[model samples]
Each structure stands twice: as C-alpha cells, then as structure tokens.
Target: MALAAFGQLNMEEPPPILGSRSVDCFEKLEQIGEGTYGQVYMAKDKKTGEIVALKKIRMDNEREGFPITAIREIKILKKLHHQNVIHLKEIVTSPGRDTDDQGKPDNNQYKGGIYMVFDYMDHDLTGLSARPNLRFPVPQIKCYMKQLLTGLHYCHANQVLHRDIKGSNLLIDNEGNLKLGDFGLARGFSHDHDVNLTNRVITLWYRPPELLLGATKYGPAIDMWSVGCIFAELLNGGKPILPGKTDPEQLTKIYELCGSPDENNWPGVSKMPWYNQLKSPRPLKRRVREICRLFDRHALDLLDKMLALDPSKRISAKDALDAEYFWTDPLPCDPKSLPKYESSHEFQTKKRRQEMRQNEEAAKKQKLQHPQQQQHGVGQTHAASHWPAGPNHPMHNAPPPQLSHAGGPSGHHYYQNPHGGTPGPNRYHPNGNQSGGYNNQSRGGYSSSGSYPSRGRGAPYGVGPPNYSQGGGQYGRGQNPIAGGARNQQYGWQ
Candidate 1:
C-alpha cells in the first residue's frame, strides 16, 4: 500500500498465489534494499543456483489474511509479462516444524519466512545515476527513458497506476535492460469518475502541483510528471530539476519554475484542499530552453509536455514513446549495448569509499594538529600519579601556562623542565599558593609596594628548596638585582 495513504482502489480481488518452494530452497546471501512491506535479500536458489532477490513480507497483524500491499503486488506482478517490468519468479516459504498432538506440522513460523522471489538485477536507476564515475550519455538516457516509458505504457494499458515512480524503483539487469520494480504503491485506476483517490502517492520531489495542492482525484498525469523529473535528472548529470527540501518548498519551486497555475491552466486549482495554504504567487515561469539548454528542440518540447502544470495538458506514456525526440539524431541506443558494470551494489561501494576517505583526511589533520600530544599526555598521567597533589593535571587537552622560578629569572620556561618539576606555587608552597603562579598575585615570590624585602645578605630572602632560602639568583650575593633602570624603578617591574 502507499506509505502515505490507502493504496489500492476498490476492485475485484485477484487470484490467490500459491507456491511449493520452501524458504530453505534458497540460500540467503547479503541484503540489498528494503521496502515498506518487506526486506529484500539477494539469495541463490539451491535447486537452480540462480541468484534472485527475495522479499520477506511482514505478517504482523495479519488476522485479515496477507497484507493488501503484498497481495496486490503478487497479483499485479504475476499478470504483468513485459520485459521492461521486473518479473516475480515465484513465492517461497518455511512451514517450520510440527508442534501438534497428532505430530502434524504447525506452519505458524512460516509467517515470518514468506518470500517473493524476483529476477536478480545488476543495478537500479538511482544507484547507476549516483555513480560519480558514470555520466549517462544522450543515447543512454534515451534508451533508459524509452524502456521506462514503455513499461509505464504497459502498466497504464492494464489500468495499473504506478504511483511511486522513482529512480531506485527502476532495476537494471546485467544486459542493461531497465525494469520497473516495487509495485507496493501501485493500484488500478478506476474508470469511475466519482471515485476519489489519495492525493499523496509519489515521492515529494516527483509529486505534481495538483497533488501538492491536495487534489485527490489525480490520474496518470502524476506519474508523467515524475518521468519528466527523471528525464531531466538523467540529462543533467543526476542533479534533480527541482530538489526542494519540504512540501511547501517543493510547491514553491515547482510554481516558481512552471509559472503559477490557475483555473485557466489547472481548472479549479484554488478549490483544492491545500491551495489556500500555499497560495501561488504566479511567479515568472522557467522555460526548459533556459533550464536545460543542452537538450535539443524536440527533447525540450517533449519535456515541456511531460511537465505541463495541467494534468489534461500532460502527455500520456504511450504518446510520449512516440515523441519526435526519440526519432531525432543520437537516437535511443539498444539497452543491450549499454556499458556493463560490476555488482548492482556499486552505489553502496562508492558511498562507503567516499566516507572512508573523509575519515582518513580528518584523522590526518588531527595528527598534524597534535603530533606529540599523545606521548605528552602519557607522561602527564605518570606525573599526575607521582605528584598526586599536583594542581589541575593536564590530560593532553592543551599545553599548560608558564611560571617563573623563585630561584631567580635565570631563564624563561623554568616550568618546562619536566625533571625540575612544576614551578611557582607547586614548587614554592605545597598548599598550591602563590596561587597566581603566572600573574604574580599575593603569596607570589615577586614583591609589591614598589620594593623587594631584600635580606641585604648572601641570598635575598630565598626560602624554598633546591635554592630555597639558600642560593641567591644567578647574580650571586651582595649585588643589586638591577644596575638600575629608571623605567623598572618607576613601574616596580622587578
């Protein structure tokens, strides 16, 4: 079902799908992608050794039988026989072991192990388009678009509305054939004009103005608009034409580019539920020629028709396939002739490699910024243990401040001498006093009141250890600390 609303429309239930293959029949490998209804795994069939994607259906709250989404998908996929659409090979399950009085097998565990096997695709349109190294050429783009439109045409002919049409849902096998996959959000378009459908279906970026304005009776025009977006993205090297961040922003961007719609363009647009919320300002419209100048006239024309703001004006998938753009030069190439790639998981590989590179660069910068910090941090740890009483130890966060030695101003950085131990308060007074070690505050060795308490003897009031109360400054004893600087005298700098 549609992730944002009720999916399938009222219709006769399709035939029940039955399968004999058990879960053990396929060897589970790595997970590839996930969906709203199930987790898809890349598995190998034990009997045929054929690689396939197995979608495990979530059977929670299934008192009403299987999920509507799975059921609809199984029914629709089984009937669709187009090569442009992903083929649902079969259904498989695990009945578990017997747990009954008569030794009969209870299939309760089978609920969690049901799988929908599908043909293995080598890549998806989203993944391939995201490959930084792969730029889709004109012919390649045309080829993919042809296949996409052809599939959509088949779906439309069968009255199946693929509401969720995005690049990731388009799978590509090794032969380069593109197939429409993921029908969970698909539903039959009722011919009854009175029946109303949910407006919310396609992804925000791909959603049309009609849906954005809250119209609930939209038709195939909604999907055509998404196709237009995909077409532009493929041509412009993967950059979406309108990559808005929110619903309001998406509407604004769309209106800004397509020109504001009114009764003349989209009849009764203002009457839509959300119209007043995001009133169109009727801003200047952005033409395809200006936005996608690289596209030739015919291609641009087709793009314009597909992106027509009015649903009635938009081209049908069948008609689009017959557009002049396909008949023009650099014609659509054969899908089989397209370049072959490694595993369909190339997108994931490229993403992880990019993340690894970023992490490595960040690590290098950190090392350069703090080369020897680790070793210094270790030494500080050892020092912290030895001094236990040491004030605010360093954990390599940053270098410590400076302090002058009480023995005298023999040189700067007396505190840097690791063997000499910390200077000032730590060395002068065990009580962490001369507290203002560097700023020279109270209890500090430097005198105040513009005068020193000179002992007028061998060692000037030196009262600590190593040279405490004993040895004088480097100048020895009985000498004036300074020969005399009037400036030093005035500022009491000494």
Candidate 2:
C-alpha cells in the first residue's frame, strides 16, 4: 500500500521539461552535496560531454522574485576571474507550470527553478583530510595554503569578502587544484568603514574575535582570521583548531588560545558594542606559541599575525603570500605534483564515520551478551565479521581504485609527479620531520595581500559591498571614516 501511494504521488507530480535549451542542455548524474541555500548535483553537459556541478537555487518559500543571495553570488562571480577561485560557467532554468487565460504562460509566474553551473571537483578539503591513514606532508600543506591565500587575495583586491571560509568551502580536484567556493555569505564593502554591517556572519569556528565582540563595521581582516583557522587545522593534522558549538563557546575557545583582548593590545576593543557582554571574566595569557610549539617557527609567526586579537593588526592575504614559511626549505610543491585519490566528500565521510560508530556499538553489545564466550577468541571473530575492511583485510591490501579525473584510467596518473619522486617530506627530509614540528616547547614568534590600497594617517577603511536588501549595504551613511593609521598597516602591501 505504501509503495502504491508513493507511486501515485510521483505520477501526479509534474514531469520536469528535460529537453529544452535551458535545463535540457545537461543531464544530472547524482546528488553530490547540499548547501545552506540549495542542493548540488553532479551533471554532464550533453553538447560537450564535460562533467559539471549544478547548484540548484532554492526558491520554495520565497514570495519575492529571485533570491538576493543568488543574485549577489552571480554578480560577484561574473566579476571575479582567478585560477584558485571557483568559476561560474552559466545559469540554466526550467519553466514554470502556470498558464494564463489564452493558455499562454503566466508572465508574472516565477520560473520553475535555476541552477548555477560550475566545474566538477572530486573532493573538498574536509573530505580529503578525513580519509583514513592519509596525512598531508609539509610541502603539500604549503601548496594548499598558498593557493587559498592567493584566491583570497584576489577577492580582497576586488573588494569582496567571503564571510564563510571553511574546509568544505574549499574544493579540490584530483589534480590537487584548490578553488574557493560557496560565495553566498560573501558581500562587497567600500573603503569607508562608516556603515553598519552584520556581525552574524561567518561559521562560528572560523569567525574572528572582532565579529564575536559585535563589530558592525569590519573589513577583509575577518576573512584573514578564517584563513588562520584553516592554516592551524592543516598543521594540527586536519582537526579543527577551534571547534566551538555555540557563539559563547566559540568566543571562549578564542580567548583560551589567544590572550584576552584589552585596550592596550586592541585599541578600540573596549568600545565595541558587545565587548562588555562577551568579554572574558579574567585575562587569559597568550598560549599560541606554547600550544603550537611543534609547528614550524615561520608558520607559527605567520599564524600569530593572522590570528591577531586586533583586526587592524591582522595580516592581509597579499602580505601572507610573502611570509617566510613559503620561502623556507620543503617549499610548496606544484598542485599537479600531488597524488591522485578517490572521490571524497564531507557528506560521504560523515556517513562512513557514523557507520563505524554503530558497528563498534553493536560489537560491544554482543560482547556483553556473550561474556563467557571462551573469554575472548569467539568474541574477536564476531567483532571482525562486523568490521569494515581493516589494514589486514584483503580489500585494504588491494591497490586503490583509480578515478577518471581527467578522462579515463590513464588520466588518473595525471596527478602523479612527473619528476622522479613524489613531492612530500620523504622526498626532501631524510629524518621524517613531517610530524616533528611540535617536538619541543622552545620557539619564538614574530611577524605579520592583493590587499586593500595603502592608507595614510587620514585615509578611510577597506571597500565594502553597497547596501541592498539582503545582499547590499549602504556606505558612508552619516558616519565617520575610521582612523587611517590603524588600517594603513593592513594594506601596506605595495
């Protein structure tokens, strides 16, 4: 009965017009992931046989016309052109079902839907990092970081801010290229910091302290703080450096890692609207160098600047590119030099982790039931039977299945280094210093992007997006421009 009901419901639904010029150009393969605003599917272009990702725009509850977030994303993508940035190929739409008196389509009726087309990527950074036993070497980490900073630099130069920067937002192809995606939370900003903006943006874990303290007017420094979180995650073996469950908890984590902010270190912190409401009860000593002692001296130095308590003191993406970490030994390798891996997505990995946990729980229950089952031998066999392939399993010993990233089986080899050896610590360091960065607690830190324009003593703030409903914000609206000296150091990159 349930099956018949389901079939009837499906039959009553209107069939999607699949062969028209709009949505008919491509065939959806499968659902790859979901985002804040809509679902994403793997698709293939019929004309060119090229694989792509189709991001469907959600308009189910919108009484208004097209979504403002989608409009802003489209506008910003059309203006941005960079290798590390995700490219927006074109948008396709389906026709609505409404008709008028003469049987003609209703002019006022909204379109059936829209899909944002993009190049298909095999994995996101989070998924790739979650693969069992997979560890990223120092050079590979540098390669990814450099690409991330480069893309962010481009966005800042163009006066755009990617408020949400997280592991899943960073897409990675089999060839090792990393492209920044998910620009829904992004907005444009003017150089004058007089306008009020929302601080309720950016993922909690990667959000900066300024935003937590309720700063309405901000700049590119917020994005740079996210970059710092990502950098620390990579260095800490793919685990998020600050995984806070709530806004209050997230702020606490920041205060714990970094020292409590004060007027001395952060000139205007005490004046922030939420400073008193969210400020730490007691001052916390700066423990960055203490906790991250294993990290490279140069990398820690850059991280310190990136995660500075004061937004004005934070490093810009352009200046980050020139940091000593990139210039040190075990230099960043070419993206193409990285190894090829199976297709992985955060959605898939989370499911797998859940399954593993369930299996373990089942095994524990079985052991509890058969407590006397030879005191060990039979229980071991039972648990092994329920386990997924382990290191000793035949499935685990077999060669990893290759993916057709470029075209065919041969294309899987394209990600392999053309040189004699793989680009990793083993190829460069004989002692295997890949995991030795925090071997001791003795290290010193000091340091500090297409960045904002150089500001003098009386200049304005970084450019921000214009005020629109949901997408745009007004600039220089009956407000004073921020002091120039504080922000001048941020845009020092000439």
Candidate 3:
C-alpha cells in the first residue's frame, strides 16, 4: 500500500502533445498545388484510407526557425469553425533522421518536416473555371458565390482577415462546396479599428481601390472589394472584370470601370498619403452599370455596393448574402445536384499549359528551319490554318487550351476576346487623362513609400514593417499577436 501511494505521488505525466501524429501515418499520392508558404500534396491516411491534402511547411529559407505565417494560419484556423472555411484537421510531423555516432536518435527534434493536413479538395476555382467549353450556369454561379460570401461572413465575424482572396485560393470539392483556403496572408484584426495592416495584399487584379491608394487602416471592407471582383467575373462568363499588370495600371482600370474616387464620392480621399501621388484624372462618369449592361439589375446593385469607393460605404458579407440577386428566380441549386468533376488544380493545369507553349515554340522553329520540305509536300493541307484531327498533325500535338489563366492582362496582350479582337469598351487607354488632371508616368510599387517588389511569389505585396506588436496583446496565440495601429502613424493615417 505504501509503495503504490509513493508511485502515484512521484509519477511524471507525459508531455501534452494533444495526440499529435506523424506524417508516416499518411501516404502522399501526388502533388496537387502550391501555396505562398508550402507545397500541397494529395495524401491519404493509411489506416482510415481517407484522402487528405498535406501542406508541407517550407523551412529552407527560414534562418529563424518555422515561418510565422504558418503558425498564424494554424492558430486562426483552430478558432474558426464553418463549412465554408477549409478545415485544418491536424498537424503531423516527419520522423527525424538525425542520429548520433552510435546510431541512436539525437537531441534535435526539429530536423524532420512538418505538414498541415486538410480535407482533399477536388479543384480550385481557377482550375475549375479555366476548363475550356465549361460555362457555369446562372444557378451554379449563384451557388458558388453564396458559399463564398457565407464563408467570408464567418471569417469577418471571427475578426480574421483573408487578405489574399483570389480564384486560386478558393478550393472547391467535387460536391460543389466552396471553401476559403490559403490563410497565410490572413490576420486577426480588432473591432476597435486599432490595428494597421499592410495595404499591399490580394492579387493585382482583385485588389480594391482603397488598398491601392495606400490605406493601412482598413477592415473587412477590403475583402468585400475582392468579392465584388469575383462577382463580376462570374457574371461576365468567367472573364476578369479588371485585369491590370502594374500598380498604376490596376488603379487606372479600377478608376475606368468603377469611376475615379473624389471628395464627393469617397470623402477624405485626398487625405490618404499616396492619394496626391497616385490619383489619376477623374473619369467622365461611373460606368458600373454601363460596362455590365448584360447583368440583371439586382447584380449591378449588389456589385455597386460591394465596390464602393469609400471603404466605410462598402457592403458587408452578411448584407451581401441578403442581396436581391439570390432571392430572385433560378435560385441556387442544391449542392448535391452539382456535377462531380475529375481532380484539377492551378499548379497542374499551369504546368500543362507551359508544356504546350514550349511545344508550339518548337513547332514554329521546325517550320522556319525546313521551309522547302513543308511547301514541297503535295497533299500537305494547310495544317497551320485548320485544327487537324489526326494525332500526327502538328495542330493536334498539344492539349486543347484546357487551362485558361483568364486574369492575364486584358487591355493588352494575349487575352483577346473569343471574337479575335481586343476587349470591347473595357479596354483602357494608356493615357486616359483627356480632361487634363493629375497624370504621373513614374509609378511605384506595392508599398506606401513606392518601392519595387522584391519578395517574388513568397511575399506578393513585398515585405513591409512587421505586422504584429512587440508586446503581446489579447489575440496573441504565442508568436503572432494582433497588429497594433502604431504603424499607421508612419503612413499619416493616424
């Protein structure tokens, strides 16, 4: 009895890992996509045979231990619970390979890889929409948009900002369920509007005017702007409403389509630090309805509210869900009724397109090198002019443009209309200032100070001042804390 009591008194408990598993438990089938911070693999659990996506955390360039973005994503996802949001099942680690001279395990526990496991999604919005000859019906578009807004509403209510909202970041399952993914750029903001976040976020095409104008003190309104872009893209038959290559170009496109922001419209627009530097000549008039003439009245109304020039005036996700467009005829179809599609992802589809381009270049070179042999063939029809059916034909050498990255520069290059002409009416003039207003040819980068983009794909907006506060706040989940408004002073917003 004495021994039992002593054992109970002195027995040590195991470290509380919370049932953390190892990556060995899951079998990686193939790589499906890549995010800003890691490579995503389509994996399956060995025991349960449940398919999942394993996002391998990138560590090569991290001289300072694990990435903070990954940590924030894991923490924010833990607090969020919604069907529209991507479910982060659990974190799994690889077995360490480091060993001592005696072949025993070493002290280093961080040598192995780390992976975040999630439910495997069949296709991202970009890939699914890119499939040629696949036009989403009105009902289907409504269903997807509703799901997106519902998920976004949940995120906003939780105070989490998904700064990067684009087609590629939205994952869709075969059952027509859409979920918000890629929380690497996400941050938890305060309700008091006391935090200042980097304005250089979201892809160039979907970015809002407020962000482009260098407004560091922002809120959920920024995300609504992106939703507005997606809404237009869906209604426009999968064409991006505003596709811009550079920062000035992006803002110009926004001005042309949504109309230039002025004191009359956006009030306090001239107060933004970069406003004087970046503001372009006011357009003749707002063209939201004129540009989207084919769209029904309800869609135009909702889009105008969402893409409001004033961030304060922008529509909230909750209000967007209650818009008239969803209540009208041809209501959203049941998600179960949506057709199942084969697995497709942006990474795989983009790679295939790259290979096709290379093949085309090779064919062009062969034709140039052997001009005589090509013209001398008696029965050789005009293969270049027509798409031949036979496998041997050069026209049939590659896939049929299955992957369409539509956000490619619209007013310019290769993104011509199906009718073989530049985009009608929407095409922007390089020098759009006919009225003789602020016109500056020397444009800058994504930062408020106007610098060049240096982080490449890793930091699409380019690195800026640290986002979090030094002294941990209420929302600090260990390393990542809620951003403070102290940085706003630098940009003159405070």
Clashing pairs in 1: 122-344, 462-469, 463-469, 464-468
Q: Across residues 1-494, which tens digit of lDDT does each residue of candidate 1 receive?
A: 22222333334555455667787777766666543444556677787767777777766446777787777777787766676777777888767542222334434444335778787776777656544335566666777997798778778766788876766678876555777877877877754645688875666667788887888887788899999988876765555566654678777888777888777777877788988888766556655556565566777789889999888889998678667776555566655456666553423433444455555556566657665654566557653333223233222112112422211111111001111111111111122211111111221221121121223211111111221111222111233233323212321111
lDDT against true structure, model 2: 0.65
| Candidate with the larger TM-score of 2 and 3 | 3
Using lDDT as the yardstick, the better of models 1 and 2 is: 2
Local error of candidate 3 at 18, Å? 6.2
Predicted model with the maximum lDDT: 2
Which candidate comes out best when scored by TM-score? Answer: 3
lDDT of each: 0.60, 0.65, 0.63
Per-candidate TM equals: 0.67, 0.69, 0.72
Q: Flag regions of model 3 displaced more than 4 Å.
A: 1-19, 96-111, 368-372, 375-494
Q: After superposition, how far is residue 304 of candidate 3 from its true place, in Å?
A: 1.2
How would you encode candidate 2's per-residue C-alpha lDDT over 202-289 as one tens digit per residue?
7666789898888999999999999999898788766566666566777899999998999888898999988999999999998888
Prediction 2 TM-score vs. true: 0.69
Candidate 1 versus the native: TM-score?
A: 0.67
